[model samples]
Target chain A: MKLSIKTIIPIIVILTACTDDIINNDASPSNIFRSFWEIMDERYVFFEEKGVNWDSIYFDYQPVFDTVRSNSAMIKAFDSILSHINDKHLSIVSNDGHYAGMFLNDTLHYSISFGKVYSTYDFSNLQTYSHLHLAQLPEGISYIRILPGLKKINVNDLNIRQYDYSNGLIIDLRDCTGGYMSGYNFCSIFLQDERVVFYKQTKAGKGHNDFSGLIPLKIKGENIIKKETPLIVLINRNTYSMGNGIASILKENTNAFLIGETTGGGGGSVMSVLLPAGWSLTFTQSKHYNLARKLIENGINPDIENIPLIDFWKEEHLDTGKDPQIEIAISILQTTK
Target chain B: MKITLFLILIYLGGSTLLVAQEEETKSRGTLHNFRFGIGPIAYKNYYSIPNGLAGGSMSFTYQMEKEHKTKKRDFLLRANFDYSYLENSKVLTTSEPLFRRFKIRLGPGLLWPLNLKNNQLHLQAGGNISFYGEYIYPTESGGKHIYHPIPYGNWSINCNALIVARYQAGRITIEESLKVAIFTAGFFPEFQYTPTSIDNSYYWDFLKINTISTIPNYRMIENKIAIYFPLANNQTAISWRISYNHYNFENSQKYIEHNLGVGIRF
Candidate 1:
């Protein structure tokens, strides 16, 4: 094809005419605040459920942000803005350290500490994996304690057949914060059948309510634990994310009874992104729902609620046989047997 | 850095020697050139890494040109790959994020000689339709099975305006080419998400067609300068090239690369 210089010159001119610079080059307070707000507005998944008025937040914070000068002030302003949302999955990290929502600052109370239980309990044939502890309590009851940040749990290592669950089995998930969703596989050993445990939906667009179709999350039952075996799951406000998910699964699918306080709600899938101002922001990217089609973001409720008297975080309470939750669990298992 | 400087100095010295030698011209029916390059690259993806990653890039290109009395028609195919390492920090530990990129471009163009007074100066103007694809991923630390590497990809059919200028100095030919994307129909993810599975459904969701123009949504410009010296047999020639490329997608994701290469034309 032959083209004249005149035609080519005009084409080039027209092409160059449609340009916009979207990148914020300056780190001014207003720019930083705008970037943070805009990023959350575009990516955060819980505005509708959390009842966050994002446009109103922008209007309110734009004035506050304009007055901010230092990075510390900026962080404080950001924290203030995030405080309006109740999502525990949301956090911002900078050189100043990690800043999270109000839920994180609320001092969650957990019933039992695995460290104390290991030091205090009379257990036999103990097995420890990364983030998992398996042992046997008295009366032929099996005890499994799951810790936070559970990445991988090999069912083979648990030696499912070696232990006896004739009396009952206790799965302790207290204070277990979020980890890989695959960590829910720990429940596969007790699953009675292949079942859809929950559903998840991710943000699909810029709109607040824009979400993808629900993707059912299924877990196959390994039948390692027989249907007649008694299973008890322990949960508290500290049990979150995958921990919350496991508790819900055990309650709905298996005959496992839940004991302890309502779980710390962190049902959403968390993802982190780097902001233009060098701060990293983490927020929920997907919403998780239980089999009942209810949002698990607030947490899953236990069958029998028990609040701990001793502070689990305090070392003085460590290894004390005074944990009422464990005693109640033992009593319940004995009664069931 | 020192080796790069030394090689550049040698290239300049060789070019000067060729410029001082006798001037010559050759007419050929078809010419093929193959090039290989490696150089340091600075990269960043706003969706993945916060800081700019320092890395190296390697590229290979093959070109075939059909020469006529007044014009040259050329077909070009090129591929470039990059690997960058993130610096360890408080947030990112042991298994730090590593950025990797691969790009492929193919196009055919027509070039017509421009009327100029100086015999040494040869200029041509035309455009080409290029098919371009790029895949970029910043690997996150964790068990590979658990943590999905979020990928940034661009697949576009673009119309590129091309400008080529050649100057004959002694027995060496100094050539410069400029190509700029004028219009693009492309696919880029509006938001970053880890695909639930490596399936066609995820690809369909991620690869929605988004038309972008040079003015606002997307922009790409590539410039290359090469010096060619004919071999003793006159059937083949050795060349050195330096090129710079800049790309902006949706004004949010940006990429810049520089390359120094050695080539042979037959």
Candidate 2:
């Protein structure tokens, strides 16, 4: 059949003329308020963990949402509800761009504490790369500090097996905060043996407690870390989210000894949403558990809870009576190897 | 609201079409013939869920036929893309969360004409790079939709091939050319290649595969049945076509939809 372009052109024009968006972008104030609350009502996984009365919340927030004449007011209403939830990942979305950050403020000096650890090695002389800090101590302990919000590191880049440590290696995750825990499994240098790393559960229904059967997440051991090579992983209260996830995994999968205080437990994997006001919100969609089946949503305790002294911040660890975590780690490694 | 507007638009377009504009006749065997058309349809649609959810569907197609006067079959190249989506334009929350399934195919095939008694029939077998995806989103009334940092959104993709057959004919008896008209129907089977676990989160590092990434034995099946009538003068520029589609992707997702559309056959 011979079809003419002259006839087809008009058909194409008429057909393509509709400017309707495939996904309806409805931005009405009431829709925004209702959708935001409904999305949270059905999607947030931490409701059971938090113990808040969701019904009362809706009743409380519905009135607030009713008063929202502008995006800023909408953001404020969202902030009021999210603040009560007190979850690390729960973020309310808006189309107009204001977020929870504009309201929530923290006074903790985690950065200063992190700086204290950096001073252990000459800040200027430390070998640095993407999200990684590797410094070989004269005591033969290879010092590696992973920063917050970093992704998986390539094994080839680390060449972890090539490092000759007479006193083993120290993976200092003092305040490491972000990224995926499963992502860092590429650093297989730490996997000691075949082990059940963790478990993950995703939401399946509208019920707040509704969840799918546990998906057994595992990591098999493969490597050449000699028995004589000792490993010491350090953690503190600020070691949260992915950092805590890393700590819990190492505690279960590796022979690495943990020193320092407990980790900051924030084990919920995140899910995101966008509001009619144009703000992007995120919150925990699933719960993660360690092999022991503990919701690492709370911090995990270290093997040896050696608290680093305040004076340890004044100078390097070599200063006796200071830096008890490092001193204990080195002594433990010396005796073990 | 948007759906009512769309229906009105479809009705307007259907009413404005020049059904009697073109005359129906056998092709003169032009080595290359180009065509394009659009239409509205109604179909049962489901993504990730078991039961079919009914919805308004749309289909678009563009094709070209190549053959010589002496050839028994024509080399046919065609691209077809269709979608079935469910939404409540008025109550965004009660909306079925935009359960959408998209089927697209483009490639070349051989269309062989069958010289039956007073009938013009064609058998088509083609190898197309077919891509099918059923996206499941969590949405609610009032236009509430889940967005970025989405921990749980399913994107099932299947890439495969298919076969089709259609019959179109002119007035067979000289007595009544318009009493009863011939319609066209086609059936196609697709072998799907899909992945089981692809954590396609926007936050992941792409260059390196995440350790948890698992590729399991995944299978998908798709079959389509279509019937179209040449409403005016045998040139189906105006026709009522109904298409039935059954798509199964692994055990987690399956869809069956019956679509009735008015299309302009080029």
Q: Among all windows of ten consecutive residues in candidate 1 chain A, which has the lowest summed lDDT?
A: A15-24
* Residue A247 displacement (Å), model 1: 2.1
DockQ of each: 0.14, 0.11
Query: Judged by DockQ, which candidate is best?
Result: 1
Per-prediction RMSD in angstroms? 6.5, 10.9
Pairs with backbone N, CA or C atoms under 3 Å apart (clashes), candidate 1: A18-B215, A18-B216, A19-B215
Q: Estimate candidate 1's RMSD in Å.
A: 6.5
Per-residue lDDT of candidate 1, residues B155-222 (tens digit): 77888888987767776777767887888877765553554321124566656676566734566777
For candidate 1, lDDT tens digit of each residue in A137-190? Answer: 889799988887786466766775888878999998887876767788777788
i-RMS for every candidate (Å) is: 7.8, 10.6
TM-score of every model? 0.74, 0.62
Report lDDT (Cα) of residue B1, candidate 1. Answer: 53
